[model samples]
Target: MYYIENVDRKLFIYTIKDVYRLEASMQEIEKMTADTDLVRISRTCIINTDHLKEIKQVKNSRLEAVLDNGEMLIVSRKYLQDIKKVFRRDLS
Candidate 1:
């Protein structure tokens, strides 16, 4: 299960898949529920566009999503397009 660290405590978000293996893992559902503009970068992580403080481009066209919580997550190259699409969809 994934655990999101909120101001008061950590919230548990579970899944049947191995994606929830890490206690600090960030799930797409959690992000999506918090913000519709969030995108699934991989099987393990999701990012909230509304909460994105910065986006750094790295090697191989990969990206790093810096959240307002000061957490950084690497976005896989494979999901880059999907991420953009999700944000666009949220605008419409």
Candidate 2:
């Protein structure tokens, strides 16, 4: 499972089959899942690396993470270095 913050700043829990609002701040959720597969890819998104399908370079030198469910999430440059470390590959 993973969590994403919507435009309204409400947290939502995402599963392979469903997504439901989870009343928690991103910071709180991050802390709760710190030791798990979840990683912060962007200010609005936290994903389970275990569910990652691929990582690709996109325009503006940003990276895109493709999840197993076919959802593509942007990985901001701010977190690019961290992602490279996790994947053990050079993203540049």
Candidate 3:
């Protein structure tokens, strides 16, 4: 189970396997977005890592992720810590 943002309405919804269900509060949605598969790119956007196509180095210490659905999201410096965790280091 996971949750993602609705591309059109910007609503946060829960994803059960292959189904998507709408309706959740801000605090609840924030926790769900903190999962490894989902990353918050901005105050208003959260993307699913599983759907990510590519991570591109953008200007100003930012990363741009292109998703399977043709949506591009920018990972700002504010969320850099979370970003690094998603792409964990081997350290071996």
Candidate 4:
């Protein structure tokens, strides 16, 4: 899976060429994929770190996660440290 997102209380799984609806909540998916490369970037989105390309700083102290597919996702301040820790771990 590339990324899983919760929109309007529904989960959507996005892949390279398709998107699928999942009968699950973000919390449930997180627990199930805790051991995987997936990391939550926002309240409604969890992305596969393996597919993450680069992180860039944006206006207003916010950050943006650029994916390999060229899609960008905003990284909220609340989860900034968590995402940083994940990348730090990956590098080491």
- lDDT (Cα atoms) of all candidates against the true structure: 0.57, 0.76, 0.60, 0.86
lDDT of 3 at 41: 59
Q: Candidate 1, residues 1-92: lDDT per residue as tens digits?
A: 22233222333333224322234434435544544565666555555566767768876577787766676777677887876776778778
lDDT of 2 by residue, 26-79 (tens): 889789866566778888888888888988898657788898888898887787
Comparison by lDDT, 3 against 4, better one: 4
RMSD of each: 8.7, 4.0, 4.6, 1.6
Give TM-scores for every candidate, taking all chains together and pairing residue i with residue i: 0.52, 0.79, 0.57, 0.86
Report model 2's TM-score to 2 decimal places: 0.79
Estimate, for each residue in 9-49, the C-alpha lDDT of model 3 and write its tens digit.
Answer: 54654344465545765456668655456666555566666
**Could you say which candidate leads in lDDT?**
4
Q: What's model 3's TM-score?
A: 0.57
Q: Local error of candidate 1 at 4, Å? A: 6.4
lDDT of 2: 0.76
What is the Å distance of residue 8 in model 2 from its true position?
A: 1.7
Error of 2 at 1 (Å): 2.0
